[model samples]
Target: MIRTTGLTKRYGRVTAVDGVDLHVPPGVRFGLLGPNGSGKTTLVRMLLGLVHPTAGSVELLGAAMPRHAASVLPRVGALVENPASWAHLSGRANLRLLDAAGSGGRRRDRRRRVEEALERVGLGGVDRRPVRAYSLGMRQRLGIAAALLRSPELLLLDEPTNGLDPRGIGEMRELLTALNAAGTTVVLSSHLLTEVEALCTRVGVMDAGRLVLTEDLAALRTPTGLVVLRTRDPARAVDVLGRAVVARSGDTVTVRADDPAALNAHLVSSGVAVAELAAQRRSLEQVVLELTGPGADRVDPGRADRAGPPHQGDAVPVRGGVR
Candidate 1:
């Protein structure tokens, strides 16, 4: 439901998003992953037409961005970076004002929509206390509730779970999963590996302002032609398998076998009582590290000195707006 061709943004000579070609299909939780200064937020802003691209194009919901933003954006809800609200106003008051400012819908249903949004974000029982009194997690949830005020078909969230605790994070995951299941396309932008692994169906890794890798989570985690099994007789299992056994530790044996079921059968037939067995697969961390270089957030002055004078684009400043 989102497509970009050669999408790029430049701050003078420094590029924030460089010639990115991204495709996100409908009915999936797509994760956009990167480090602190890897341009994930910049890319999300460009997609929402909040930041103009220096070169290339963006398409959302089958329509060109900015050009047709007024028509398309109403059907899209977004929460970029942090959610902002008047600290002095109650959460419900803030949402009421926001909903009133937007076009479309009958005025009579405003209260109903606001209540539904609050309830969806787990703020249904919240009192009318000023937002300044709300905790960080409460504020985060309020922002998510604001985005859901419209019940848009598409959700573009950036660092959605910033200040949430473990329980709050889990609740957000469940909420996002439920939304996706109900046919709303979700595009989540974050640097948290665990969050993406738990919530996303597809993933795109970004580094140095480039879209380095994109793949389905299942495909990326495919078995690595190795089977790990725990048995009471590790030595006996190793002796039975011979060269096929790659490593052994105490009661565990790792075998280089393509078929796990066949390997298990052989081990059991040979008097090897297997306790636990599973195929080895590459973790998302391994795949990301393999495809991308060090995070752009880290800068080594010694390396820079050895490399001589830095290029203009080499030191891309990550200000609040750019991030």
Candidate 2:
């Protein structure tokens, strides 16, 4: 478990993380999501004591960070930014060296740890191969194996599959999921929305250096929008829509209303030929975009007054970070 209260960091005039209060309970594949430069890495670094925060405090497990970073880190595994590995060393050799530095007891125990880590990340067969000779996916796996060398109870992963192919990404997901299921508590930061939706049970979304939303993935997915309609008379259809919040563009109309069946039936009976009627929900990426961008100021659809656009700011979504 990790918790931060009012955690903040500043460099000159720039603020990387601002007033973020986060609570990550145990046994969760927690996802930290942000646009590029949104301080995901800065927050992670501050948590691990790689960078000191300007204010606030961090607690890892049950102990305070920075003050107890020395003792607490041994129980945590982290792969942040780019992984460091000796290119000339074999996969097993790299892990062996790391395991030697952080022994779990006997030499046999260390070796077993190394072997199990390699197998867990799908690098056991290639342990004998030099890291330079391995593909990007293999090298990524090797870095993860190094992190698991200590059998850490918590894993902090930042873009764990950044350069990997699709298959490699899938493998990384499975490995991380297995680690969490076994009670390791993995904290993941990824730009891949689908990846987060699939692997993370809970998520904390950051925007403009602020922690905007932290909730269970199921509850966070409640916003549905854009009921699409294709009718013969676009103008008449708008009136036939009654008091339902509606948006019209040429022959197509989109409404915030949830029921398409009643609306379709009304339009048909009113002599307004209906071509297509579909009620669509926002995709995970779309939801994230709305939550982080200027649309964050928009009201809920149920409160929408037919004055707001169907969607906004997503064509060229805000891509800047706090730093």
Best by lDDT: 1
The list of candidate 2 runs beyond 4 A from truth reads 223-279, 293-323
For candidate 1, write residues 60-114 as lDDT tens digits. Answer: 9999986998788778888888777888999998888888776447867998999
* Weakest ten-residue segment in model 2 by summed lDDT: 314-323
Error of 2 at 288 (Å): 2.3
lDDT of each model, Cα atoms only? Answer: 0.84, 0.76
RMSD of model 2 against the true structure: 10.2
Best by TM-score: 1
For candidate 2, write residues 126-149 as lDDT tens digits: 746677888877777777777787
After superposition on all C-alphas, the RMSD of every candidate to the true structure, in Å, is: 4.5, 10.2
TM-scores for the candidates: 0.91, 0.75
- Pairing residues by index, what is the TM-score of model 2? 0.75
TM-score of 1: 0.91
